[model samples]
Target: MSGTKPPSALSSVKITFLGTASAQPSSTRNHSSLALHLGGDVWLFDCGEATQHRLQKSSVKMGKIQKIFITHTHGDHIFGLLPLLASRLNGSGGTAEGVEDPRLHVSTGENTQPLEIYGPLGTRAYVRNGLMYTHTLLGAPYVVHELRFPTDPLGDFTTLPRNAAELPTGRNIDQIDGHWPDVFADNLVTVSAAPILHSVPCVGYVVNERPVPGKMDPKEYIPAIKRTKTPMSVMSRLQQGEDVELADGTILRGPPRRHGRKIVILGDTYDPSPIAPIAMDADILIHEATNAHLPGIDPTTKEEDTYETVEMKARSHGHSTPQMAGAFAKRIGTKRLFLNHFSARYAGDDDVNAETAEVMNAIGSLAAGEYGGEVTCSRDLMSIDIQLPK
Candidate 1:
């Protein structure tokens, strides 16, 4: 399977931080959302409030979103889901000025495939009820797959009473060795999930791309092929791991395969060690750091603001400090650590205030203390590209 496509077909993976705030959004941050761009398709991690608005500002296209994975149903994490789905239903057409108003346009010749949404147990009910109560007749069909746990209550899996837009069935989430089943997969990538320690039944995701064919050395093969009078079609077959017999009856072998990149994205959690096995040796890890304490930089040196105190408080609320996020990245042997889900009190990296810049630096310093990898404190609209290893 790895040698099916040429190495040039390998898509570049990029992550855009749509929102980086924790529970409450500050002026600089919106909420908890991330847009992962793989090839031409987009996979949204969490759809917090104004996620659609954020998409408008980002390079991610609303029509290109193929799937949405909700970690948990926290309001800040999922408030914008309904609106985003509704927008997808509405066609891109609008007034001559190209301004889109949902009320004005229902469906204007827009053809879209069914959107797939994956989330915790209550997700189906929440989406169905929200659409039904709002009287939103979608222009396109959608399906919601709930990842149910054993402790969750058993309920009727029915579509909305009046609306038949939702598909009846969804995938079930069963556990095995601390990992849930593979959430999704295609020729491009495979996505797996694991239950992480959070205030609610939250899950973390790992996206692993399929390996690609190694680069064929034109210098080495072209000379031999020309001498044998081999057709160009033989080169394509050889690149696909097929032994090809040339015009002179000479056999040519394909190049070795190269491993694809791995990306790990987690929701808010105090401890995410359960996913370490699957997340091992990831190229990039996006972990949440809702709170942190820096002794010298922080003005509040009070007893309650000590490192121990702040860490305890953060863990009690099912959150993590920068140190905790970094530790988890180290545990999983991630090459790059990106800290997100910051408290509103800390200004973003874009802020011009010296004090806030110091705070952000302190946060990165704290995480760097635990993890020796490249640490980046993510801000709203920040984009990072992950290229395949040469």
Candidate 2:
């Protein structure tokens, strides 16, 4: 599972990792950034430094990003926000030579739909200050949504779900269902957020697609079609689960549809336990593995910190290790786990390779042997296609 090639972008939910490094940048890995291809729209998560440059290297168009979700106000996570916004507003993401470059704009003319940015309390302040300090003139439409817990940090949290139907019911809240922040949702998909323990206020996101309609049994319909001589035009309606009356007054019913895909994307966090329930049965879990050691392992026992033992630094920094990510995915019962947000020390050196090998093997073994799932170490520009349940 660690090195398996991802499927094509045609899948219903395609996740592309743009930046897999943590606060520090390595030659090969940039900061933290991820792109979620939902239908034709693109949603970004944690746009780190040089994320626009990272986007230029990927197939995703920056202009197509409708919403940007920031996990927290950490510099590594939100540093690229201002520049990315400026590019979109000034049309700098457009092609200068009219060539088919990945950096070129996919949309032409003025964008009518305002780009919506969602994040915790400090997000609006950070964006506003960055724009003011940089003296950048914004010409494109945009909006910022600040998320907050309704009562407590673990209580009802605010989000901008595309549809009202996606909101959790009052009964569910009363039952103290895992606090899933209602994020943006649409007719086909629902995105939720949840708080995770970190040095600052941080949140994780989940994208769940609606179940698709089941295919009609042609054999069952064929008999009715022969008996009633039903018109071929009504076949489409019958398959859509509509009770269609045939030419001879025969009624045909459709079957229940299948469930859709579910994906969970997290930010830089130390304790991801709060998201366990919300991530239950998720198709994919994108989590941070900033260290190579297991959870609770202190890499700082020695007076001087070395590359060989950095787990202690991760613990002090409120970040998770590969084992922690694997363990969390297993507890949540997710099918696939992608570990990212790796420290720069593990970028492309022999020491890092050895460390990564050890970490990956440990994650895979633990996920399968203990947690009943699979784990993969994420890399820059890695594309994973999330297929709908068969």
Candidate 3:
């Protein structure tokens, strides 16, 4: 059996929930957004309204954000994208060659690389039009990539006005299983997306970390090398899984590699089971629980409000209850489940009232009933460190 390892271990990954509200924003909760801090870079899941403002309140650094992934083009899911991109531009003494507008003087000199943005169909048009209408000057370059399904409406890509700084591209989603092709890949992690059931074309992401090398004890190998009068360079070869032949004619084998952690984050969806194949055995699953049935503890629940009725209502609105989140987690064999994207009717974790605590507890309980693993009701600015097996 594996145990929870600390963040200091190899390939540390942490998840910070910036906003947890469904469609509406309360005083305590913002819209739907989360940040994944992977090593030096931060990858954003969704950027809703006031997402940049929420980032200021959290520990995540805005400058470290390298990529932004949008689940859908809903207002609650992507309204803040333009503002966030504009914020990245800083004033650097310069102006456009053909135009002399002061607002267009912002420079991308400080930016090291172009920020990559990925989303469903229409994301390219949305970002391009938003920037064009607002006359927003980006200090850095940005590229938008759209994942289109067969059912999505087609657009004339050649007709759209093009800007040199904004590089837009589109690709078709896999027809066989509704999987997205060429999502993203880096030295540390590989990200993939799959279409889920929703009113709009929404996607659920699976982030799989690259396998890390096993720990090698210096005490075990250093002393042995000294006694054999072997060069220290042999240790590097052995650590790379090479059988090193020392002066003593003894072969030293490297430790076995350790499997990396997997994380699944879904957008607002009534059913997300389509992503089960890629999300199997995830270390943590973050699923939306827009509405739930708390029975006696719920203030909004009436005598007629039963589990079946509540679930049906939630599904009708293209949302999910806590039970549905739990069932999906169980199906994917997730070790831990975090419920997010709560309805505006429920008080948030910041609320000091008793009802707030009871509602949060009830949400966790509902999910735990279906999934035997640990369950937590996520709140705005909540940061969770992903633990690894021993």
Candidate 4:
């Protein structure tokens, strides 16, 4: 549980933190950007300056970023979107405006998946107006869906998994089911989005594991013991979640199953209360701590104006502090609270040696420590690998 490495590019579901600094840039950290590696593509969360450059520095292929989800339109949140899109299009044999792929590398797969972009109301303006004069065009093999909404649904799973399937499969809306959204799955991970309270319109994302029920172990099955037609018939029943009806009127039962791990990353938020249910018992919680203080509007006393004491700067701006981050992690019962968007507090000092203690006093270490969880500050190009807890 303590020793795990980030998955390689060949992995089906993985996440990489491209940049973890806050609004300002420093030597140790950049801004806020994360790459979600699923199926064969990387879905970007936020694009700060040098985001595409960071992608090149890591193992993520620029071609794999088929989708990009922006939380808000702040310069810290979106400065790199135009540049990254341009580089990707420039590299893919096209100018940057929209996607247009003449030739694609396709295996003997059952489906063709298109690229998609989802963001706040001004997303089209950023693409059509701001980047339109850049002489860049998209040349992918499939469709390029660009959507802009006034408000994002906060912490809702009903539409997220379904949309991820649809944008790739070209399935009709009537056929899409909120109950299950794997209709267009291509060996990819499931991603869900919800709205969070920030200074602007922001959304948080949760990436879940869709079971490869197709790859379950066959050696432990009773059907492998039997011969002839009955054995094959029994195997089908087990996979389909059906009870085996025996010739002698006896039945063989199937056991219930457990779920894989989940990772939640809230781009930048003011209301973490809604995240409790979404991140309940999550393996890891990687949240942005932009503001270091809690938020409140009080006229009576100093304590009335604050909700958290994780940082001092958050008192004026709406951001999270290390202490506030710990409170949210404790409430959600996460395995670990990886604090990114670090201020200049650590200042090149090793957190394992000094920063951890500062954070414990700033926020309560007892909160995160109760469940064997910890607070690890993110550094530039640092990789945290999550594996199944043993």
- lDDT scores of the candidates, listed in order: 0.82, 0.71, 0.81, 0.56
- Candidate 4 per-residue C-alpha lDDT over 73-167 given as tens digits, one digit per residue, 9 for 90 to 100: 78877889877765665423333576544422322145654455655555544654444454344433222233223333333212222211122
Clashes of 3: 1
Best-to-worst TM-score order = 1, 3, 2, 4
Residue pairs clashing in model 3 are 108-139
Where in model 3 is the C-alpha error above 4 Å?
Answer: 1-11, 91-112, 153-158, 168-177, 233-237, 350-353
Every model's TM-score: 0.89, 0.77, 0.89, 0.67
What value does the lDDT take at residue 18 in candidate 3? 96
By lDDT, the better pick of 3 and 4 is: 3
1-390 in candidate 3: lDDT tens per residue? 123321222356899999999999998789999999888789999999999999999999999999999999899999988888888644233356775655453333544367888888777888878777766656567777777777776663335585446643434344456686448876667889888889888989999886665678867788778989988987765564456667778777766557688899999899997888889999999999999988778767889888999999999999999889999999999999999999998767644767788889888888989887899988899898997655
Looking at model 2, the pairs that clash are 160-183, 160-184, 161-183, 161-184, 161-185, 162-184, 162-185, 214-257, 299-312
CA RMSD per model (angstroms): 4.5, 9.4, 4.8, 9.4
* Tens digits of lDDT, candidate 2, 237-295: 65545666777777777665566788889998888887777779888888888776444
lDDT, model 2: 0.71
Worst 10 residues of 3 by lDDT: 1-10
**Global fold similarity of model 1 (TM-score):** 0.89
Worst 10-residue lDDT window, candidate 4: 171-180
Ranking by lDDT: 1, 3, 2, 4
